[model samples]
Target: MQKKLVLGTAVAAVLAAGTFGAVSANASAPAAAPAAVVKADAGSDNLFRTNHLTIDAATDAAEAVLDAAEKENQRVSVAVVDRNGNTLVTLRGDGAGPQSYESAVKKAFTAVSWNAP
Candidate 1:
């Protein structure tokens, strides 16, 4: 009974030591990758860029351009777009009809895409 108790204690001590050693080793291991570590940006869908446009600015520019059209009594849609072919803002004159908004945006996108005046 004494020998068995001693042997059991030795086995338990060995297991406890091994567990402590393993925990100490793991604690001293090198840290994992940092939270702020930057990785290579993949694919073409980059989210870092922005195109700015204002309703006021686009409205002013477009109004000036469309003034002549309106003066000539033409019911045409005018579109305005930013430098990246994105629609900024649009204005449809009185009697310009329902599809005017679509036409204006399309024209603006086309103009900006092709870099037209």
Candidate 2:
């Protein structure tokens, strides 16, 4: 029993020593610096960061479309998309057809694809 106790204590002490050495080695190493940020110029190939419309502008465009529909005495849905063809605003006028929502989004996406106003 005494021999077994001594053997267990010796194994534990060796493992503890190894863990302490590894921790100290890692602690002494220098940390890596953060990556630097680079800004893209107007003619740069970073297209994703360019030609983005703010939420307010997108919403205004959508409202303008809705107002036009109102003047024509028609209920409709209007969608405004960013340069990336992602819908930023979708407005469904009162009594508009259920499918009008999808139609408006598709129209917005088509305009973006064709680079039209």
Best by TM-score: 2
| Model 2: residues with Cα > 4 Å off, grouped in runs | 1-51
Return the clash pairs for model 1, or none.
none
The stretch of ten residues in a row with the least summed lDDT in candidate 1 is 20-29
- Tens digits of per-residue lDDT, candidate 1, 1-117, equal 323322222222111111101111101101221112233466657635332434554454445444544565645445555456565445565666676667556544554455443
lDDT of 2 at 47: 41
List the candidate 1 regions with Cα displacement exceeding 4 Å: 1-54
- Over the stretch 1-117, how does candidate 2's per-residue lDDT look in tens digits? 323322222222111111101111101101121112334786878643323344554554455555555665666766656556777677787878787777766765765577552
Residue 114 Cα positional deviation in candidate 2, in Å, after optimal superposition = 2.1
Clashes of each: 0, 0
